[model samples]
Target chain A: MRTTKVLIVDDEVEFASTLSERLSLRKYDAKAVYCAEDAFAIARSNPPDVVLLDLKIPGMEGTEIGKIIKQFNPAIQIILLTGESENKIISENLGKDISDYIVKPVEIGELTKKIDNAMKEKEKLDHSKGQP
Target chain B: MRIWKKLMVGFGVYVTLAAIIGIFAYVELRTITKRFTVVEVADDITNIILEVRRFEKNFLLYKDDDTFQEIKKYLAVLTDDTDKIRKEIIKEVGTDNYEMMKNAIAEYDFQINILSKNFKLQKEFISKIGVLTRSIEKNLSGDVLNSFLIVRKYEKNLMIYRDKDIYATLINTLNSPKFATAEVNRYRSLINGLFKLYREEQSSIEKIRSKARNIQTFTEDLSKRERANITTILSRSAILLLFAVLTIIILGTAVNIKIANSIATPLKQLEGITKKIATADFSKRIDVRGKDELASLGTAFNQMQDQLQNTMRFLELANEKLRESRAQLVETEKLATLGRFSAGVAHEINNPLAIINEKAGLMKDYIDMSEDFPNKEKFNVMLNAIFDSVRRCSSITHRILGFARKTDITPEAINLNSLVNEVLKFLEKEILYKSIRLELELSEALPVIKSDKIQLQQVFLNIIKNAADAVEEGGLIRISTGIKNNTTFQVSVEDNGYGIPKEMLKNIFEPFFTTKEKGKGTGLGLSISYGIIKKLGGNILVKSEQNKGTTFTVEIPV
Candidate 1:
């Protein structure tokens, strides 16, 4: 039996609140936090299945949070949210270890699809590690 | 006109006076010379007769006493006196016309002296015969008759001497041709008639001598009077000539100065001003003091200078303003483009991200439901659902990339009429929802213009979007296009929207110059469209009437 969890981080209270509402309405096991510091505190207690990162946050940058999030929970799938359509730095981070990246004003329909793809990629990697 | 002619006439009067005086002086000179000639001749004849009377008296007193000795003394004295009078007459005759008068006077003097000598001889011989008359007292009348015979014997000799002198004077009259000497010939004829009277005993020799004395006195008075006349005329001529000279000098000098001022002074003043203007010192004004053509010309010159200065200043100010306005327009354009792209960047990334988020959540649910499925194929279906989600994510990425940078550019030949219609159709739903009635008046056969299609489409989309937002439901919008120059064209979009406020009219084309509610419009729509048209060698202009309508017309080159 597999248990899936999702984490969302951003500085915008509205975007985080709205995203949490939508995720819960759609039945995803997700949690939202406003800053990277609070996110680390929650992740140590219960590591998420996947992490959604915003690069333009006020505290620690999304890439910095992403690095820390991965260190604490390497098996977790990570998806970077970039407000810019073509940010090479964000995309480069997603390619190496993150499961995916999405540019904002993210369509609600598109975000859900990206989340599913990332979850499966994470699952495949874990399964391969188990087999080895 | 009258003044100038009057001055000319005044000058002419003075010149005439000078000329008349010159002519008077010339005529007076000839009259003076003529009067002098008559007086001078009368004086000469009078002096000669007086000398002759003295000689005759001396001969009568000295005759019998000295005989030859007395005769010689009388003759010598008479000869000296005659020579002196003859020399005086010759001196008065001068060289011009008196050579003949000189010869006749010389001959007459010699003949009178010879006649006086002959009378002295006869008087001496007759006084000898008077001594013998006492013895013959009975013949005493005979003796007295002898003395009478002696006097009678001298009568022929005296007449002869006077006749010779008269004939000599007549010859001088014919030869000298002087007017006063013609009187001398008349006197000579009178002397001849006196001799004839002495022969007739109607005139004695003494009476003839007295007549001669009167002729001499008359000649002297006439000659003296003529000389006085000549002196008076000469002096008058001198005085008149001197006055004429003085008048000519004074008036001629005045005329010279007047003419010099007329010709020189005005021309010299004009030349001075011309030099100043030539050197670019146009600040000076030529004084037009005279009421003449030259003064009018001076006024014209000053007016020309004033106009030139005004024109130069206007052009300079215009040039400065043009530079300033152009610079401001360019700065405004830069800000406009930046604002449009900035807002566009955010929406571009956000839309794709939203879609990805929703799709992923659906896929996650699918994967989680595998255990509850009745068949084993549910797991397989869940895995396929994951694959579909991945493909959808890729397309989202592509769409975000296209919208973000605004670099999906493709230029093509497109008619603006058709382009405007297409944009209007695409925005129909939004237009209807906003209660704006979209109208079309596309021109047929608008020229094919070359431009970036998708960019042009975006421009039209933004303009229509604003127009739609501005108007209430059912408010009208008109889209139009027109041809120009065979290869250039224009598109115009008009709407009965809440027209741009008067205060904001000037800034309508500026970036972020909008009255739209915050967060709803970035205000880059018109600004970006402006840049688009401008970059494609075209321009955008807006005409808006407050509360009435707004129209945006874009002109593009082919």
Candidate 2:
């Protein structure tokens, strides 16, 4: 199994820490941040292979944050987390991003599988670049 | 009674004057009549005295003794006549002095008889003296002259007797003696009696003259005094009458003013207040001025009007508040209905969008990784499904936007009867499926009404839906169109179905006041319909009785 780069971004500090620790055992280089600004900082610095974005964030909230980060690198994949059941927040905010969503209180193993799939996607890019 | 009092004074004065004057005049008339009768008696006495004196003159002045004897007979006749005059005079003048005058007259007659006897005896003496002493012619002349002188003396006695009442003189002379000599003493007694009579008569005349003076003086003075008193009384009575009349006039005017002011002032105030209130203004009140019953009555009337105005104001405010509350409630229910609808859309549209998104993302990955592979049918279904979900979402948003729009209608010519017929046609299948018999009494050539067509259609649809829900099998809904006024058209939708309950009737048009089961009716249909109808410059009225039917009448002015 190859190493997978996963970014867990949420304003819940304890939640992000616990989730990142769990992902570490699953062989994912998972990091966490409380805000879109820090997430962007970390993304530009280490550049995570896949971003796990929370829809509600303190600064530059997830919907617009997804757009800005996608503009920076469109090939970089994103999966969204939503705490609210309001369709307006879903359709109006996150609909344009075409990002996949998992309602919160997700299973840890299910998150790990999502990260593995994203890493494979990154690997295909690397192998293609090597062949070229 | 005032007249009685006034006439009382006049009658009293008249009675007093009549009584006093009647007595005074009676006394004066009696006295004057008595005086005249006395004068006539005195004149007769004087005539008898003169006749007696003339008889003595006839006996003495003639030289014949036979003539002298005839004169004595006449003297006796004159004496009886004088005695009758004295009795008649006494009967004529009714006084205590009547007996005095009568006695005096009898004595006068007695003196005349005595004088007549004396003259007869003296004549024989004179004839014998003429025979004794010769110088016959001179002696006859002397005898005639002496007889003439004696007759002249008797004439003087008669004048004195008549002047001083000889009858009274004679009677007084017989009663009191003053003469003293034999023949001369006999003559002296007669002469003394004569002198006494004259003195007594003179005293009586003096007393009568004094009485006449006193009576005349008193009557004349009293007449002047009484006249002055009556004049003063009349003037005083006149002043009192004038004052009484003025007092009556003044009091009458004051009473009239008091009555007019008491009535007219309050009445005028009431008229003004009533006029103001009749125009539906209730800002002013009348002050009750007097504590009289009528003033209290005014207070009560004003209070009643005040209460009526207050009640009217209260009703208007309550009705306005009710309308406002109904609007708020309609808005709330509208939001609630939108929430319920969106919830369904979220569950139905969003989850499918999620599936489409997942499949689309997988498709993109398959295409990216395996360049030679193409799953055409699968990708097409996925893309089509995604497109369809998106389209449904947009349509749902459009429906919500259209339903929630608060567009105000600009009025124009509309055929209300056609609008009603169109709505009924749109709803006829629903009505027929529900088994509600529809009746239409559309008036031909109905005038065009100025109103909102969409709003009218919604109202008709909602009312028909409500009627369909109310009626069981064999129920009827009748729609009638007519002209209400020159500028108004009326449409009535009547249902022979279960009517609204009396208590619920008041809140029928209020939002969320549905009698339908939960989730079947949001209860805002009627409220929104009513609001729309009202906004379109029209009125919707409902008349219903429980268990009988319901009727909705819509009036829209042209």
How many pairs of residues in model 1 come into backbone collision? Answer: 46
lDDT of 2 by residue, B228-316 (tens): 54455556655655665555456545554665567677778888888989999877787777666558768998889979988998999
lDDT of 1 by residue, B1-558 (tens): 233553565577576877688678767965665454444435434554555556555645553333434434543553444344444334555443244433334444454444455554444433533443223333335644464344334433554464555444444533443323433344334434444433433233444355444445444554675576678778878887888888777876677567556546666877887787778666777776666555676788778877866876788799887886676567555544554565466454454445455455445555565466565466556655654553454443443344335533457887776777788789868876877766788877665666788768878888888888888778988888886676557778899988998889888766557778754665566766776666565778889998898998887776
How well does chain B match by TM-score in each candidate?
0.43, 0.40
lDDT score for residue A63 of model 2: 73
Q: Measure candidate 1: CA RMSD.
A: 14.8
Off by over 4 Å in 2: A1-132, B1-398, B428-436, B443-446, B465-475, B482-490, B496-527, B539-558
Whole-model lDDT per candidate: 0.63, 0.61
True contacts preserved, each candidate?
0.23, 0.00
All candidates: TM-score: 0.42, 0.36
